[model samples]
Target: MIRLEGITKSFAGKEGAVAALDGIDLTIARGEIFGIIGSSGAGKSTLVRLINLLERPDGGEVFVGGERVTDARGQRLRALRRSIGMVFQHFNLLSARTVAGNVAYPLELTGAYGRNEIAVRVAALLDRVGLSEHARKYPRQLSGGQKQRVGIARALACEPAVLLCDEATSALDPQTTGAVLDLLRQINRDLGVTVALITHEMDVIRRACDRVAVLDRGRVVEEGPVTRVFLHPRHAATLRLVREAEPDGGSLDAAAASDLGGRAVRLTFTGPAAHKPILGRIARENLVDYAILAGRVGHIRETPYAQFIVSLSGRDVAGAIAGLRASGVDVELQGVAPVPEIEERACHVV
Candidate 1:
């Protein structure tokens, strides 16, 4: 329930004004977990802050639930902010305040609830985050995961409709990161809160977000459903991020060369058509040797897709490729590898 239209933010630099967000146009549907991903200096954090008016845009409009949020002053701004809760990577909790106290602080600021109501809300929120036992502990008394749970409880104290997470799990260990992500997913599902997370971790996006926008150098290079984007990333930056999570040596060109070696074709399969056992049937029917060089299995939108590199050795490599194409496989033959002669190593013919 948030939209940013042509939002641009620039700051004075030594040479000139440097744009942090360049004409960012994006929309977050109600009750959807949206992810914004980019490398360092890509303005991801800046863009998120603009959504809550923590950083005012230099140009364009910021709308929350279709209501304009820019240029708001005093009470208007404060009220708008209360509707949006933010969590950070650092787990910004006060060392002096106990977990319960920290959560109650936000409700106190709203000043619309009595002491008992605030106490009830705080206890419920703490229990929701699975930190009911740690209610009396200060920030220093808890672990990183516990501290983040406190931050999450504090964020939910106001019952915000939109939650902004800026690298929320970056500072935690992998196991704890997963735990936090699960909590976020539960928050979205149970509370129906619209979540917008800015993170560099694809695993986080894959596990949590329903849609994603890939930002590069203050501009969104790609945006779409999480599964679609993961399966067929159109941008180089997007591909880079995906590849980082599952590393494969060499570039795409190098991979093509090593796999094909000017011998066989490269095939691309997407959607439901990719699920067929094409390779198995081809190998079984053809009396030729097929050597698989490199391949990987990955999930996009929680669906399995495989990318493979293989070599075909026989007198009729072209025939095998043609047969595959005829069967509705996307095949591309690069060149040909020199046919190797089979020589008798020893006297097998006794």
Candidate 2:
């Protein structure tokens, strides 16, 4: 487990001190895959570095497994680092080293094992990462994904209790990214190693993170379970990230709104509500004619969710909205239509 309390870090900038992290307070539970997401220059990378003391915080404390390691030095710092493993965006493998040799490098540096022990440990690690067949091969001979597998194997050489992944899948193609994500998930489940990954990709967070923190301009603007944050992004930064992740969906057009003759509303449904026949029931009971402007149904982790941009024409628009809300559907009135006013709610969904 890792905890950062009131963490703040800054560096010299052309305009003076620039804060890479400001007043950050985060707790990553043991064995959980926690994600830190932000755009370029959003301080995601700097925050991750602070965790391993690669960039010590200008203020506040860093705690791992309940130990305050903010000021640890020498052997203490080295020992703390050995319990944490890091993988980079670029597969940081020694090009001259064979796959086995890359994995053995860390163990050799520790000087805690003899030749036979290091060889056995390296072989087991190669096998664990499914790179046993490539053990004799060099980095240049492997594909991008394979090279990353080598990087992962090397990181695990120390058998660290925590894994820090810095944009681990950012460079690969979509298919390869999925493969690497799957491998990380398997590692977490099998090894019970706590994972803290930083990326600009919302898809990566959706697929791998149990909880997430959205960073913007050196501040944590939002943080929550992936399902809650993804399905109903509260911050503008979070919404922008979500839109970038799924840009295929069209927004409700003004012409479409004018033709519907009533109210345009966005509905969000999650879990069992996503599969229920609530829409049909609402239409039958309220006699409302509904037009689907745009929508999507997908999974947030394992939970099924559906979001719809609907145009509704009916005598009881308020009743319909209330009905949907009563059935656990999140209903937001699109500004394009003139509808009865209701109490404002979180997510702008009444």
Candidate 3:
């Protein structure tokens, strides 16, 4: 329910104007968890802030639910912002206020509800975020996850249609991150809140996002369904992020490459193909053998995917690759390894 059209933003720097975001065109569907990912300084944080007009764009339009809000000011801007909730990486809770008071602050600022109504709303929000038991506790009295829950509850006080998360789980431990992600998913499914989250962690995107946009140097390099982008990353920026996220499936080093005696290829299998013994069947049919240099079989969101880097030999390498392609497997020929006797190792032998 959010759209950015050719959005550009720049800032004053030592080197004159430095562009933080350049020509960003993005659409996040209603009730979907959309993720924006990039390394530090990639303008991901700036892009997220632009959605709520926290950072005004230098050029282009911002639309929410089909309304152009690029130049919204005064009450209009305030109203637009009220309809959008934001949660920060560091839980921005008021230390002086209790949990219930923190959540009630937004409702108080809106001046739309009476004291009784604000109290009811605060109680409901606290319950929704599973913080009812800590309603009277101050920020210092709560754990990191609990503080984040308070932030989430406060954000929802206005009953916003869209939720903007700026690395909301980055500070939490892995277990806490998973729990927070699960809560976000539930909020999307049950409350029908449209979520746009920006993070550097691919694991967060894989766990919580339906679609993702990859940013690099203020430009969007890749954007697609999480399954497609994660399984078969095409852009160099995307590939780098994927490798960092799945280090075990990284490319072979020079020493490892020297051991394999033929063509090196990477195969990506998805859907039903991922479940099949296609590699074995292709090898038996084409009279070829392969040594798996690196491989991983896992799910990207709900879709099962298998990726393998293998050294192919025993003549018929081209035929085997063609067979894999015909069977809907994506194959990338990495290059031919040096010709010699293949090393007998404990790697995946097929």
Candidate 4:
């Protein structure tokens, strides 16, 4: 339930104005986890701030929950902001306050409750975030994940219809990251809150987002369903985002660069096609030899899927290729032999 039309924001640089966001057109549906992914200076953070009018756009419109937010001022803006909650990379909690106290702070700001009312709401929030046991704990005593849980609880205190997470898991370890992501997913499902998250981590987007917008150089290069974007990324930046999502313990640039002498096609299998080992069966029945240079089998939405780049060898090259294609399998001839030159060319083009 968010729409941004021709939204542009700029800041004065030493030489001239630098466009942080340039004519951005975005629409996020209600109760959907929408993601904005980009590297540093991609205007990801600025775009998120524009949603809440934390950074008003210089040109174009900002609409949140069907209300215009670009030119909202004073009481109107303050009232509109109450329906949106934001979390940051650092768990921006009041270190001086206890876990329960921090969650109650938002309610206090709105002047909406007495002490007992605040306590009841805070207790419920602590329970919702699984921090009831640590209600009295101070920020310094909690781990990064717990601190984030506190931040999330605080954000939920206002019962905002939208939650804007700005690199919410960037500071935590992988285990903690998964926990926080799970918590956010639950928050979305249970509370029906629309979540908009901006992060450099593709894994975060992959796990949390239903749809995503790939931002590069302050422009949206691509935006669509998470599974579509992950399986068939259209842009270099989009592919980069997918690579970072899994990574296989290293950068995708190097992994993709590894020479696969034959044509390397990124075979994306989905739906019923993904569940079966069709490729393996074809190789076995046809008596063909194939070398799997680099590949992975993973799930998107718990559906079994895989991608592999294999070097095929056999006498009936065209026939064998046709056989796989005829069986409703997706295939592409990447290239042949002379691996290094082809890989170099691909890298440069991307």
Candidate 5:
């Protein structure tokens, strides 16, 4: 588990000191996949570094596994860092080392294991990451995904309790990205390792996170379960992210949907509701003619979900909206200005 309180970090800029993180408070529960999403300059990488004491905050406290590590020094700090593994956005592998050697490097650095022990550990890690066959391959000879697998194997060499994936899938193609994400999920489940994923891609969050925090301008604008945040994003930055991740091949933007005229509402269906005949049944029952502007049916980390924006005409439009809501569908009136609400996540849970 990780907890940060009033966390603030600033850096020297051309103009002056620039705040990279400001008054941030977050808690990541043990054994959960937590996500931090934002655009560039959201301080995502900087924040992750703070967890491992790679970047000390300008102010506030840093706690890892319930120990206050803000002021830890010498051996204490080194021990704490060893308990938290980190995966980089870029595959920061030693090109000079082969796959097995790369994984063995971290264990060798600890000076706690003998040569035989390190060799056994390295072999097990390579097998765990499905790279046993490529143990002798060099980084340059591997594909992007393979190289990342090597990085992951290296990170796991220490058997850290928490794995910090800072844009771990950002450099790969979509198909490769999905494979990496799936691998992370597998690691989380099989190893009981708490994963904190940092990325700009909403799809990554949707695919991998149990809960998420949306960052904008170095502050957390919203945080909650992925289902709630992805389905009914309450912040402008969060809304934009959901739109960008639309599986309907880019849903109509607010500006684009404005000219459609009829009363428009976005509907979100989840779980069994996603498979129900809610839309057609409600339309007929309420006698409302509907036009779907954009939508898609998909899964968010195995939870079936569907979302669509519909323009409603004919009578009883209100009745139709009510019907959809009564059927477990979340209906949001389109074009309505969003009220930014930061839902406090169960980050404090132990």
Candidate 6:
């Protein structure tokens, strides 16, 4: 639903020209949640603003729904902006307006709907966001989550095909963050709205996004399906982000695996295979004694996955690996993985 090509933007810094984005190319499919993640200075916010032409790029093009919006002007620009909904991190609500009024503000600006029509639309939006009871309340009376809900409702007032979320959950607590992400997922599933999310948190992408693009130093260092990225991150930037999201920096010291004193292998298993007793059964069949040197259990979307650094003790070590591989387990024959950062979301130990 959204595409950016060879997009480059730079700003005048005290020292010189600072490149915020350079040669960025990306495509966000319809009805999917796409996340762009990077550190504080990685230009995540600037890239997002470019989508709505809030900040025009110095080079390349921005397209929405296959229409080139890079050069849109006046009424065309206004219409384009209205079609793309934006939810800010700080819940930029109109302080004086009531929840109902805040949601109706966008519709009021368009002047395309009658009073009754706008009223009905506002009511429905509030109901959809579960804020119907707080319609009469002002932004000051609402919690952070409630205010964000109002912002979401306001953004969706026009039934946009795309929703741009700029650090949408960064301001909220973890519990509230989960709740808000659930709401976004529901919105995407029910409305078929393509969502473009920007964040520095890898957890956010793991929890909600279908695909992800890892931004670093003003360039895309990594991009692909969320499951693939989480399971097997390749780029240094992507690995760093994954490690930062882990407990105790997310990896065992090489000493831990090497000290086990046998053929060490990193075993990766996912989905229903993770739940099966395949590892134990294969070990027994091959007459191997395996010790779990280190491991983690987590979910990729809804699918459960487990990665383990295991030390094998037996004559038929290769046989054990072969058996596991034949059963669809990913086997890597490295004695000591320096930084194995396979991550998980849910707490279910598979």
Model number with the top TM-score: 6
Instruction: Show the lowest summed lDDT stretch of 10 residues, model 3.
Output: 337-346
Instruction: Arrange candidates, best lDDT first.
Output: 6, 3, 2, 5, 4, 1
Tell me the tens digit of each residue's lDDT in model 6 across 273-316. Answer: 88889999999999998877567787766877888877787879
In candidate 1, list every pair of residues with a backbone clash.
262-335, 262-336, 263-335, 265-332, 266-332
Model 6 score (lDDT): 0.89
Location of the lowest summed lDDT over 10 successive residues in candidate 4:
338-347
Models 1 onward score TM values of 0.84, 0.91, 0.90, 0.88, 0.92, 0.95
Q: Evaluated with lDDT, which candidate comes out highest?
A: 6
Give the per-residue lDDT of model 1 (tens digit) for 1-350: 99999999999999999999999999999999999999889899999999889899999999998898788889999888898999989988888899999999999988899999998999999999999998898899899999988998899888899999999999999899989988998999999999999999777887789999999999999999986676556787887777666533213333434444335444555556568888767766675456544444545544655555556766566777877778776665544432111111111110
**Model 2 lDDT, residue 260, Cα:** 57
Question: Cα RMSD (Å) between model 1 and the true structure?
Answer: 7.1
As for lDDT, the candidate ahead, 5 or 6, is 6
Output the better candidate (2/6) by TM-score: 6
What does candidate 2 score on TM?
A: 0.91
| Superior by TM-score: candidate 1 or candidate 4 | 4
**Steric overlap count per candidate:** 5, 0, 0, 3, 0, 0
Top-down TM-score ranking: 6, 5, 2, 3, 4, 1
The parts of candidate 5 lying over 4 Å away from their true place are 246-261, 336-350
Candidate 2 lDDT over residue span 1-350, tens digit each? 89999999999999999888899999999999999999999999999999999999999999999999999999999999999999999998898899999999999999899999999999988888888999999999999999888899888889999999999999899999989888999999999999999999988998888999999999999999998888778888887787767554223354565565767887888999989989879977888878766677777667888887777887777888889999999998778532221111111211
**Residue 339 shift from truth in candidate 5, angstroms:** 12
